[model samples]
Structures are given as C-alpha cells and as structure tokens.
Target: MNSLLPVPPRRHWSTWALLAGLLLLVITSFATLPLKWGDFFSADAVRTTADFLHGFAPPELSPNFLLKVGTATFETLAMSAIGTIIAAVFGALLALPASGRFGKAARQATRGVLNVLRSIPELVWASILLIAAGLGPFAGTLALALHTVGVLGRLFADAFENCPPLPAASLRINGAGPAATFLYATLPQCSPQMLSYTLYRWENNIRAAAILGVVGAGGLGQMLKYHLSLFQMQPAATVIIAMLLMVAAVDGLSYVLRRAMTR
Candidate 1:
C-alpha cells in the first residue's frame, strides 16, 4: 500500500525552458557580433600578449613612485570610508519612512527617491560630478556616497520591516510613544543586520572608489590610467598591485568586522 501511494508530479519544465532561453540568447548574441575568434587564439596573438605582459615585470619600486602609489591608495581608502559613513547616516534617516514606520505615503515617496538614486551608476555619477568638482577624490567620494545611500536605505528598510514585531508591539501596548518604541525595541534588534549591510556595501564601495579614479575622480585608478596611457608599463603594474592590495585589505577587515558584529 505504501509503495502504491501516488507520486508527486515533477515541475521542472519551466526551469528547463528558462535555461534553453538563456542558451539561445547567448548563441544569438555571439552569432550577431563581429568577433575575430581565430585571430584571438592564434600563436602570434599569444606571443604578442606575452611580450606586452612581460614589459610590466620589475614594477617601478623607486621611492618616489612608491610614495605616489601609497598616497593614491590612502586616497582611495579615504573616499570609500567617508562615502560609506555619509551613506549610513542618511540611509538610516531615509529608512524610517521607507519601512512604512511613518505611513504608506511616506514609504512610497522614500522608496521612489531611493530607486532614483540607485538607478544611476556610480561611474555615471562621478563623470557628471567631475565637471563641477573638477576631477578629484571629492567627486569620487560623492558618487560613492550617493549610490550607497540608495542601496543601504533599501536594505535598512527591509531589515526594519522584518524585525520581530513582538517587542515593538509590546512597547506600544505598554503606552510607549512611537519614537520610544522604535528607538528602544525595533532599532536594537536590527542594528547588527543594518551594520552588516553597511559593511558589505563599503567593501563594494572600495572597489568602486578605485575605479572612479579612471574618470579623473582621483586615486589608484587615475595613476593606472596615466601610466598606461603613456606606455609606462612598470609604473602601471605598480599601481595595479597597489589597487589589489588595498582591495584585499579592506575586504579582510570588513569580513572580520561583519563576523564580530553578527556574533
């Protein structure tokens, strides 16, 4: 009787159809592109690539060049740190309305603002701001802050909304004011998660900050772009190495912080 029990029907056709659609899209894209597949894989191409890469060996390690790289690395770090801090403060403020704590009208309005803010990429923001800021770390920092505010605001709102309601509910039942209830009950439970989200965004902002320099927004990317344009492969390599090290250090630090906070 157990063996004869009715079997549940498999419902995997939609997944298979989705995979097939993706495969077809990829094939179509490749077929339509004017790609030089043969030249890319040719022995001569490989040799040229190797020679170009080899030119970057023994990266410029002179004291002056090292100092420049160090300064740029610090600039990038500062841009990301400041940007994330500004975003965290503003994001928390925006989250209050976005989480529907105020009212439906406020939640909708704040969410719309966040959507507009995040819709524009950081690179685009930097490019636009470079005209006004005149090409420096300041533009880069603003770009990162603006984009991060949207991201963190949305994440923070979700964290607030998903917090255990019992605490806030109890506070209200005991005659606590709205501000008091949220401050004492709701904010405490979700603070760690909000912090974790901020840290994660900071990790991304570090990488973005480095790249923003390419647009003359200031930092390691500007150094890399300048050196590369002049065919100074050694110096470019040094800048690239600095970027990698800075990113790695920030990633490690953020990971440790997030772990500690979560614990």
Candidate 2:
C-alpha cells in the first residue's frame, strides 16, 4: 500500500545556521568563564558549608525579634507597592509618546529617556540615591521607581504599538479624536496586558526592596546583613524566612489577580 502522509518539511538553512552560531557562542562564552571546579566540591568547602548551615537551626522566634521583622516586612511591602504605583503612572505617560501616539521625534526622545532609566540596575540607582538622599527607605523607593519606570514604560509602549489597528483606524475614520480613539480602541485591547506587566514588576520590586536594604536603604535586608555580620545565623534565618513568606504572598496575590484579569 502507498503511504498516505506527506513528507515533513526539512529545516531551513538559516535555522541550522542560527543553531550552529548559538552553539558556538555558548561554547565560547563558557570557555571565557573562570570556574575553579577543583575548589567547588573540595572537603574543606563541604565542612565550612555544613558548619555555617548548622548555625541556622532553630531560627530566632523571640517576641521582640518577630516584632522587628514584622515592621521591616511592612516597610518592604510599602516600598514595593508605592514604587510600582509611581512607576505605572509615570511609565504610562512616557509610553504614550514612545508608542508613537506622538510623532517620530517624540517617540525617539521618549524611548531614549526610557533606555537611560532602565539601563542602570536598581542596586546602582539605590547606591547613587543613597549618597544624594541619605541612606533610608526613601532612597530605595526612588531607585526602584526609576528603574521600574524604564522597564514598564518600554513594555507599555510595545503593548500599545502591538494593539490591533483596525478598531483604532475605524474610530479615526469616523471623526473620533486621537484621545477618544485611544480611550475606546487602543486602551481596551492593551490594558489587561499592561496590568499583568505591572503586577509582575511589583513582584520583582519586592525582592529588590529587600536587597536594597542591605545597602542601608532600610528594609529586611538591612536586618539580614546586620545579623550575618555579627555571625547571628538564627536571626538571619528568621529574616530569610520572612523574605520567603513575603515573596510567596505576593506571588499568590499576583496569580489571583492575573487569573481574574484573564476571565
């Protein structure tokens, strides 16, 4: 009997070339890293790790320590929430221009500003702000907000640009103004996606807020650093647990909100 199925299409030359190039790049990149494999699993390393880990047993659960951790936890949450809110507002404003709602010159200018803002890591921003604003949650909050604006603005602009043009075009043809077209057509399509991005960034900012505290920005990370510096592993462990719990809670909330949005 003759075979009924058609032959599968062969991979394109460009695909194979791209794969080969990626393989070469990965090999070259791996060769450049200075990895000391001999020390990684050495007996001394194992003993040191075990000893350090031993100290973390029975985390500090004292009333005062718990109270302090609770306060720090709230601070981190507030910083992340406020930073995200400010970034969303500012990012949306910039995104309008970057999305080409404005002319090409405006888009280029807005994008350039976003590139500069997002190029610097949050920690670097925090470090600089610390010098100017003095070490506190304020500096950390600003750092998170600035970096997030870059990220969110870029994402929002892309979302707006990718929105279906048909509805917007129809609105424009019917004498709807640009603002009305955006409000009725462009926004409705992309707002859900923008909200999803904001929530995801908020999750990241929470983790960043915790780390920023290590630089004396005032959060749980500062507490973790202090305890670790004094070799107080139990207290450090408590902080770590608190960080894990906070991250989990945010993740859970994001999941719920995202699910609701999809519906």
Candidate 3:
C-alpha cells in the first residue's frame, strides 16, 4: 500500500539553478574581498584582543565621570522620545495621503517623499544635520525624527490600507463624510497598530540616538567616541554599559506598552 502511493513531485531545475547561482555569488564575493583571514586567526591576534579587552576592566566609577554618563544617558533618552513624537505626528499626516485617501497622484507623490526620507540612513541624516545643528542632542533628535517619519509613514499607510472596510462603508452609507468615517471607524481599528509601529520605531530611534552621538550629535555615543579616541577604555566601557542598560529598559517598556494595547 505504501509503495502504491503517488510520489511527490521533484523540485524544478530552476530552483537548483538559482541556489547554485547564489552559492557561486557568495564564493565570488568572498574571493574578491581584501580580507586577511590568516592574520585574523593568528595567535598574536588572539593575545592582542585579550589585552585590549583587559584594559576595560573596573570601569571608571568616579563621581564626576558617572555624572557625565548620567547626563549623556538622559540626553539620549530625550532625543529618542522627542524625535519619535515628531515622527509620529508627521508620519500620520503623510500616511493619510499615502494610503490613497487623496487620489492616485497624491498617493504617488506622498509615497515618493516617504521613500526619499527613509532611504537616507539616520547616520547620514545626522552627519548632514550636524553641520547645521552644530554638535548637540538637537541634531541627533532631528536625524532620528526624519528617518523614523519615513519608516512609520509607510507602516501606517499599510495599516490603513489593510484595515477592515465594512465599518467605514457602513458609516459612509449612514451619511458620514470621508473624514468622519475615518475618524469614527477606520482610525479606531488601526490606531492600535499605528501605536505599535510607533513604539517599535521609538525603540529603534533610541539606538540610533546613541550612535548619532558618534558624529557629535551629543549623547552617550559622543562620550563613547571621545573616550575611545583618547584611549580612555575604562570610561568608554562605562558609557557602553550605560547604553546597554538604557536600551534594555526602553525595550522592556515598549514591550509592556504594546502588550497592554493588545489587551
């Protein structure tokens, strides 16, 4: 009876060909890179890494340095919070048109703008803004806001598009205007999703805020850069530890908020 069962179809040759192509591409990429694999694996490299890591022990616990780290941590948190707020506002505005409530031309134009805003990385945005904002948390804040706006805008538009249409249609049938229908029906359904996306983006912005400081945007990243440049490994390690703690805290908070919303 088992032998009489029909055989499963074999995968097509195209699948195998595509996989082989991908494998070859990977091999070619590794071959073309200028990496010195032998040096990376050498005993001297291992010893050097251990020695360098050893320099960071007993992180600078002095009162003055801890004060500075605390200030920088606050700045990072503020930058991410303010930037996410700004992004949430602008993203929702953009998402309205991008979701096609304003016709095809408006949708296309709005989506194009979103694409442009998001395509430029946060680091690049910070690098450009640093010249104008002049080395502070404000620059980092703006950078986070701009990039996050693009991301949140796209997610919001998708949520709006996928929202259940019956409630909106019923509202319209009962004489609700487009805006009223959206406000009374569509928005209520998708607001939770929008909030979730915003919280997720805020989580990401927190990390970006820290890294933006590397370009002198003013935060823990800036402190880390300064200490590392001067080879102050102990202080740099402290900044790194602060960054980890802050990130972990924000992640937990965002998770709790998202779960609450779902319930």
Candidate 4:
C-alpha cells in the first residue's frame, strides 16, 4: 500500500505550541485593540500627524540645547557602559554553573535560576528600581544591569554548552579544574558570540536609556518629552537626529570591534 492514508502533520512540541499560543494571543489582542487601521489613512489623522511633525522645524542651531544634548548623550553612554559591564561580569560568573560541565545537579539549579531571571522584562525591572532608587540614572542603570545579567548569563551558558566538549574535557582530563578548562577552552570558543551579543545589548541600552526618562531617569528622552509638551518640534527633531547619529556611530564601532576580534 502506498500509504495514502493521510500522513500526519508535524507534531506540536513545546516550542511550536508556545508559538501557536502566542499567535492566538496576538489575534485576540488585535480584536480588543482601540486602534482602527483606517485611522492611519484618515484625513484628520494625517493632517494632525503632519502638523505635529512640522513643529520639529529647523534643527540647525541650538547651542545651549546642543550642550545639554551632549551631556545627556554622555549620561546615556555612561549608563550603558556601567550597566553592561556589571551585567557581563556577573553574568559570566553565574553562567558557568548552567554550562553542565561542572555537575548535573548544579546545572539544573543554575538553569532554573537563570530561567526565572530571564523571564522578567527590563522595563519592569527598571520601574521597580526607580521606586527604590528614587528617580535617576542609578535606577535605570540598575534596572538594565539586573535584566542584562539574566539575558547574557543564559546566553553565555548556552554558548558555553554549545561549544565542542572535546577541548574542555581534554583539559579537564589532563588535571585542569573547571575554572582552568573554562579559561583555556570554553571561554575562547564562546568569546565571539559573547562579544556580539554584548555589543547588541549595549546598542539597545542606548535606546532604552533615551526613553527611561518617562520614569524620571532623565536623558534626551526627557528633553524630547518636554519639547513635545510645549510643541517645540525643531528641538525635538534635533534630539532625534542626535540619537540617530549616536546609534549609527555605535553600530559602526561595533562592526569594527567584532571584525578585529574575529580576525
């Protein structure tokens, strides 16, 4: 028999089921959303949006504002660096246990902890820290660090795990302890992936820092909010331009750094 008896479709495993569930949630959410798609094309909506955009005029010369922008930009850089460094250090520290190269029991415990940590969003963490730290870059930095730790730690552990065990295991067999083998073998293999993810996160943090002002963290986003409230489109445009430039610069630098490391 040629088995025309209807072949089974793919089995819905945990991953596929999760994806399907998410799709259903999105479908249900769209049904409840207040927005109408037609509004984007509506005359009034277009006119209003155009008028708001127009308010952001001649972003050419604003020396005082530029200086302020410069300071805010620096603050953003500082925040991203501090947060990322803290997260990277701590994440690396914790990721080892999850690598399963150490022991089965430790790997399970570490993975469970990492799962809990990675489950929460950075914004939620930021909001909570904002409460405890009372409104500043400190709160934003802490928020980003805490969240980054979870993300990068899990990623690091995975990268470590995915590497060929031969090199590390050989070192261990030759009397290398877990730490020694990691330094010589596992860390090097994961280095490229780690750097790439870290750089990506750093870029994201720049964008996140810009908007953390909604929680009173204070950055160019705060300035943008102020300008929008007062209907100062020109200055707002200037801030947006500056952010674009900053992000572009970060992207370029990261590309160079990654190439250098890989080479």
Candidate 5:
C-alpha cells in the first residue's frame, strides 16, 4: 500500500554539538575558577582527615551529653510528628478543593492558591518563623508546619485525584453536596493512601528537624554545631550516630505503614 504521510527529515547534530560545548564549559569552570586543587589538598586536608578518624573510635561517653541528646531527640520527634500532622490536616483542606472532584470554579481557585503556597520551601518558612517566634523548637515546628502544608497538600491532591470515580458519581447522582460526598465517599477511599503518604513525610521531617537546629530551631543539629565549632569530633560522632539511628527507625516505620496501607 502507498504511504499517505511524508518521511521525516534526519535529526541534526547541532543540538548534540551545543550540549558538548556546554559540558566543556562547565568542566573548565569547575576545574579552574573554583579553587586551586593542589593547595586545598595540602595540610588543611590532613587536619580534616585526622579529625574524621578520631570520631566515634573512642566515642563520647559523657552522661551529660547523653542526657542532652535524649531531650533534644524527643523534641525533634515531636516537631516532626506535629509537622506531619499539620501538613496532613492543612493539605487535606487545600487538596479537597484543589482536586477538582468538586465544582470546576472552586477547584481552579483552590489549585491556584495551593500552587502559590507550595512553591515556598520549608527551610525558608523556618527562617521566617525564627524571626517571628524567636529561636526554639516552637519556631521549628511552625516552619515544619508551613512546609508540610505545601508538600502534603500536593500529595493529598494526587491521592484525591486518583480516587475511583464510581463513589463520587454515586454521591453526585443522589444530589448530595460536595461536603457530604467528600466526607462519606471520598475520604473513606482516600484515607489509607493519605495516611501512608503522611507517615512517609514524618520520616522526612525528622531529618529536617535535625537540620533546622542549625538556624537556632533547637535539636541535635545544634548539638552537632557546638561540637563542630569546638572541633570536638568524638561528641559530634556520637550525635551523628544517634541521628542516623533515629532516621533509620523512621524509615522502617514508613515501610510498615506503606504495607499496611496496601493491605
């Protein structure tokens, strides 16, 4: 049979050539403009290496430091948990209207607002809250909440968007309003997925809370900063180890929650 369509032209090499030129520019900038590699690899590097090796080999066995770490870790967990909960609750509110399962006009409006809110990062929120609330876990919690609102809102919208249409249709056919259908039909179906996603966000927030202390938010990160400032490698190593263990535990919990949601 005769072909109805014309053959497409061969692709040009100019795009590939341009990409190669950009790659070369990037390599040259890094290799030349950044720093003198030889000097950077000298005595300063040796001192850094020495500091690294001394870490956790003997480890900090200080009872005071251990007490401090324990208290800070609890605060960090509370911050992350509260942050995840705030994110889920606010995100659900925003996601409900933004998902377009309701009226189109309301959906468009809600989505536009959510887009605006979610564009900002959690760290930035923490910075701003620090200014307003002063330095502490309270500020960190607020920061976590604001960022969680954005991240969880997007996930909430996705979960809502992917929900089966049958339930929604059944509710609509019965002349049920948006609020009623959502509470009865939509929430029941989407809750499991939403819970799983929230739990995962909690895991991430734990790490974030640790870092927020660098900005005076109060957590193990602040303790880390103190050890780092004093060049106290052993204590720093202990703090780092504890942080890693906590994050690992959160990861295990996330896996369990995800499986539960699936079941």
Candidate 6:
C-alpha cells in the first residue's frame, strides 16, 4: 500500500482513431510518391538551373518595361478587387441557408452547392470560362468570384454557427422576426469575422489572378509568360519582381485591415 506508482493519463477513443488515420494517410502518401532520387540532384539539373539563373542576372529596368508592368499591376488589382466584392455579396446570400437559418433541407442543398463550388480549383474554372468569355481579365474575375463565394460562404456560415445564440434568441423572444434578429444581433456579431475572411480571400485571389493570366485570362502573368517563352529572362525577371511587390502590398493592406477590425 505504501509503494509509489505512476498513473497513466486518459485519452479519448476519437483521439486514438485520429492518430491511426493520420499515420495511415502519411504512409499511403509516402508510398504514392514518384521520387527518382538518382536523377533529382544530378549534375545536369544543377547546370541547367545555373544557366537559367545567369539569364536573370539583370532585370529589365527600362522606362517602357516599368510602365507596362505598372499597367498590368493595376489590371490585376482591379480584377481581384471586383471579384472579391462580388463573391462577398454572393457568399453572404448563401451563408444564411448554409448556416441552417432556412431549415435542414435548404441548409443541406445550399451547403452542397458551396462544397461543389469550392471543390473545383480556380484554375480549372478559369480555363473553362476562358473558352466561353475569351482571353481577358473578365474570365479570371468570374473564376475568382465562383471559387471565393464557396470558400467565403462556408467561412461565413461557420462564423455564424459558432456565435453564441443567446443574443439572437433574446431578440426572437421579444417578438422580433428572423430577419430583424439576424440584422440587429447575429449579423453584428459575425460581420467582423466575415470581413476578415473576405480580406484574406482577396489576398489569395490576387495571386490566383496572376496565374490565371498565364492561361490567357489577361494580366501580368500573360506578360511574364510571353517573355519567358521567348527566353527573355531579363524582362521575365522584372515581371516576377512586380508580382512580388503586388503580393506584398496586398498582404500589408490585409494585415492593417484585420488589425483595425480586431481593435
């Protein structure tokens, strides 16, 4: 009875199950990898990479190239902004049903739609839209909006669902209609979180828009692709730098806005 003993901590069954699943998935993924280790670090690969780097030694700094880059930068910005705005509107509309405000059947249907929309990558959507809309930023904007609506809709719905129901319930108890309760109580509680997600999506869309351009959706990506195709690495380097700057600027703006919202 006086002997010292160590006690084992308790663990939930689900926790063990999750760990098993993760281990299995990792094992499967490793097995599936098509690695050719012998060729990976070969001398030819190293020399080819060095040759490419040599071509990028000096980026084109001429006034004409800078002006072209500046114009494409604005176009990219416009496409992302417009796309995010449209997605926010559509996402908000779908979020209500997705959050179960309209009963189970409607909720399931709306959620299914959102899942489908988000499951298809934006690049795929852009390629499909490109055929219908032709080569331009318009197709890219549509692609961004579609995929973002699905993402923001799911996010907004989750934010709404996670909010404490007390305030909305109180409003309802006082004879407030569903719409009024949502407007005066639920929306106010969730708007900041929704806005934060929207801003984050906008940042991602900026990068997506650039890539979409390579598919003929029209932006700095198109210019970069053109130069790279011709082996004009100097101008391609300039375009790459411009892309980095644009991404950094959007990231900074998103950070400031998110901080302001939290404050």
Which stretches in model 5 have alpha-carbon errors above 4 Å? Answer: 1-51, 101-105
Segments in model 1 whose C-alpha atoms lie over 4 Å from true places? 1-20
Tens-place lDDT digits, model 2, residues 145-190: 9999999999999999999999999999999999999999999999
Global Cα lDDT for candidate 4: 0.83
lDDT per residue as tens, model 5, 1-263: 35867778876799789999999999998888857768767999889878778664777878998998888889888989988888788999888777876689988887777776667666788888888899889989888888778778878888888889799889989999888888898889999988988888888899999999888898888888888889888888888888998999989988987997798
RMSD (Cα, Å) for all candidates, in order, is 2.2, 1.7, 2.3, 4.2, 4.7, 2.7
lDDT of 3 by residue, 127-212 (tens): 99988989899998999999999999999999999999999999999999999999999999999999999999989999999999
Scanning candidate 5 in windows of ten residues, the lowest lDDT window is: 113-122
lDDT of 2: 0.96
Best by TM-score: 2
Model 1 lDDT tens row, 162-235: 99999999999999999999999999999999999999999999999999999999999899899999999999
- Candidate 3 clashing pairs, residues 3+ apart or interchain: none
Model 1 lDDT at residue 205: 95
Q: What is the lDDT of residue 112 in candidate 1?
A: 98
TM-score of each: 0.92, 0.94, 0.92, 0.84, 0.80, 0.92
TM-score pick, better of 2 and 5: 2
Q: How many residue pairs clash in all the candidates, one count each?
A: 0, 0, 0, 4, 0, 0
Model 4: runs farther than 4 Å from truth? 1-35
User: Native-vs-model 5 lDDT?
Assistant: 0.85
Q: Give me the overall lDDT of model 6.
A: 0.94
Error of 2 at 66 (Å): 0.5
lDDT of 6 by residue, 1-263 (tens): 53666667899999999999999999999899998776868999889889979999699999988999999999999899999999999999999999998999999999999999999998899999999999999999999999999999999999989988999999999999999999999999999999999999999999998998889888899899899999999999999999999999999999999999999
